[model samples]
Target: MTRQRYHHGDLRRALLSAAAEAIAESGVNSLSMRDLARRAGVSHAAPGHHFADKAGLLTALATDGFQQLAKALGTSRLASNSLLELGVTYLRFALAHRGTFEVMFRTDLYHAADPDLLAARQRAADALYAGMADLPDAPAVASEEVREVALAAWSMVHGFATLWLSGAFPDSAAEDPVEAARVILGRVFTLHAGVIPSPEAS
Candidate 1:
């Protein structure tokens, strides 16, 4: 019998990449350390060295998801752009990275309280808000105020993505999720006093 070596090139990243695909195809509930190791062509214990247990692996996955999301949302555009574009991007990420998106928000599985995980999550959220803060229509308020706005923005996009992913949205919506998300989120972004004002309201 041949023994597998632990010293593998980019083992952590390899495992994460494979796990992401597995989670995308089969929910995290279907993922196992041994299965991941087999997919990675490594020993079962190899994953433990990087992630102590299932929760640990999930934490790492969530952390990485946050980092990637932050990067995607962090791109700087015009000096005074609309957050609607950022919202579109967020929805796009969820569609593109379905697996990571699922784990990142599923607090039931991943430990949101873990310091490392918490910090990563916060950083990702902060990155999104920071982009919003630079928007032309950004409210002139405290950080928390902007955060609230960010949350509202996030909810619209996240909701649209979730519905789309779950196939709850009609096939017509899938025909153009981005445009659909944009229209739905545009209303949420611009609506006020239970009414979406005309462009002349500015």
Candidate 2:
């Protein structure tokens, strides 16, 4: 591969972009720092300069993914003001950022204890919990109850996205993932509504 020079700050970004593309095309197990440097048109040691090793690169990628997810959820919440819409947005992000999505949750692939990664993950969690708080009919529940509801909502969307990505769904569902998700989420929300106590009861 021809070695191309990148401006000081650009090298890190370029290598990260290449890593995401590589992981998306051939899963994380097949990814290598040498291949990433080659893909980025840089010296073999270039990626190492920015990321000490493959784990470091993945940690950076996962951190970015969580940050992006948090922003997407926050924007959806502000714009639509609906937990249902937030779920849809979450699915959309998972579909659109397949490479990052694949790595973000796999703790073994990255440095799970990295401060930046932890902070980013927390931001995403906070955003999801905030969405639960905004539900129109949702009453003022205890923190534990709120956490449980948030987890349920997160599980629903994350499970659906993971299954869809792995081709677990039929062709018909794949053809219109957004609509498919809307239908599934609607049912989940409907069932969920029965469990949450009314404001008067709360």
What TM-score against the true fold does each predicted structure earn?
Answer: 0.83, 0.89
- lDDT to native, each model: 0.77, 0.85
Each model's backbone clash number: 0, 0
- Candidate 2: residue pairs that collide: none
In candidate 1 the C-alpha lDDT for residue 16 amounts to: 82
What is the per-residue lDDT of model 1 for residues 115-158, given as tens digits with 9 covering 90 to 100? 98888888788777775555765444565577787776677778
State, as a TM-score between 0 and 1, how close model 1 is to the true structure: 0.83
RMSD of each: 4.0, 4.1
- Please identify model 1 stretches exceeding 4 Å from their true place: 1-9, 76-80, 131-134, 137-144, 172-174, 192-202
Candidate 2, 54-155: lDDT as tens digits = 999999999999999999999998988877788899999988888889999999999999999999999999988884765773434666698888888889
Candidate with top TM-score is 2
Off by over 4 Å in 2: 1-5, 137-143, 172-174, 195-202
Q: How high is the lDDT of residue 87 in model 1?
A: 77
| Lowest-sum lDDT 10-residue window in model 2 | 1-10
**TM-score result, candidate 2:** 0.89
